[model samples]
Target: MERILVVGVTGAGKSTLARALSGRLDLPYRDMDALYYTGREWAVNDDLVATVSRLADEPRWIVDSLGYPEVRDLLWDRADTVVWLDYPRHVVMPRVLRRSVRRTVTREVLFGGNRETWSDWLSRHHPAWWAWTQHTSRGREIAHRAADPRFAPLSTVRLRHPRDTAAWLAAL
Candidate 1:
């Protein structure tokens, strides 16, 4: 699919799926985290909206991002297809926790040169905690978006399991 928008909770593998799709389809990929972050901080780029609008106008691209309100409408308006990774909490919590631990242990640099720390991991704002708290709410939001008549022109794919995601990608 062209102009794909991948959305999900923190650990639902949105980035992974977007990257895979980009590679398979020979399309460019953008991770919204990288666009939203600056060196070690969450600073919005002054040109963020315009930049994304420009990308959205492209013929083909894969964008991976959480459904942040600021740019949600902009991206969704341009996306021909939306991929929602709707894996359950039981399936995603461990994935997020392990990812957090691994990133912290390995000192992997994330977007904006930020690295995960044990202290941050324990914080309420941690990705894992965010995922746990927002899981159901996020699912409801995606469902609402899918059912909205305004988005009628868009095709939405909701994957409820990891295996389902794999199969969808394979079929693609």
Candidate 2:
């Protein structure tokens, strides 16, 4: 699929799947986090909307996100295919937790040159907490988007579990 958007809850492995799809399809891959966060301490790109708009105008791309608020609708409107990783909370929570813990333990550098800290785990914005708290709501949001008439041209692939996603990707 061209002009793809890989969407899901915070820990649903959207980035991973998007990368795989990009490689498989020979499409350009873009990580929303890398584009949104541009500096240290998680500083954001002020021109994110404009930047994303430009990217969306391109002929092909695989963006790993439903997108942040400001650019979400634009991306959705431009996307021809949406790969939704709708894994349940049981799957998402452990993933987010393990990812956060590993990042903190290793002091791994992330987008914007930021690193996850044990202290960051206490923050509401932390991926683990966000995934846990927003799991159901995020699922509802994605469902609504998938059914919306405004995005009628879009073809959606909703994967309910990791195994389903694995098999789907393998087939692709």
Candidate 3:
């Protein structure tokens, strides 16, 4: 489907799946983090809403995010399909931990030219910590959004495990 939103809690691999779907479906792929974090030091793009709204108007796109507060409803409203990664904490925690460790150790550059540092692990914003703390809440939020009447007619593909997602993607 076009105008897809790949959504999940932190570390659920939303970006990875979205990228894969973009290639498979031949739709433009947009990483929300890249769009939101526009410069060094994670400087936020001041025109995020305007920029995202413009993208939402496009005929075909696959974005990896639940969307930032300002654009959450807009993305959901415009999306024809939503791919939800609903893996359990057992599956999510290890992924986030490994990703954070790898990024920190390799000094891998991420959105806005920012790299995860050992010190960054102390922050609540760190992926590992954020995922651990917000896992349940995020799942609830996603569930509510999926069930919301306002977003009706939006086709949803909810994957409960990594294997399920793999099979679904293969079929797609």
Q: How well is each residue in 1-172 modelled by candidate 2, as lDDT tens digits? A: 7899999999999999998999999999999999999999899999999999999999999999999999999999999999999998888888988898999999999999999998898999999888988888988999999999999799999999999999999998
For candidate 1, the per-residue lDDT at 54 reads 87
Cα TM-score per model:
0.94, 0.98, 0.98
TM-score for candidate 2:
0.98
Per-residue lDDT over 26-55 for candidate 3, one digit per residue giving the tens place of the 0 to 100 score: 999999999999999889999999999999
CA shift at 161, candidate 2, in angstroms?
A: 0.7
Where does candidate 1 have its weakest 10-residue lDDT segment?
Answer: 36-45
lDDT: the better of candidates 1 and 3: 3
Overall local distance difference test of candidate 3: 0.94
Best by lDDT: 3
RMSD of each: 1.3, 0.7, 0.7
Candidate 1: tens digits of C-alpha lDDT, residues 1-172: 7888898999999999999999999989999988877566556677778788888889998999743577888888888889999999999999999999999999999877888888897778899999999999988988898778887798999898999999989997
Candidate 1 Cα RMSD (Å): 1.3
All candidates' lDDT scores?
0.87, 0.94, 0.94
Who is ahead in TM-score, 1 or 3? 3
- Alpha carbon lDDT of residue 35, candidate 3? 94
| Comparing 1 and 2 on TM-score, the stronger one | 2
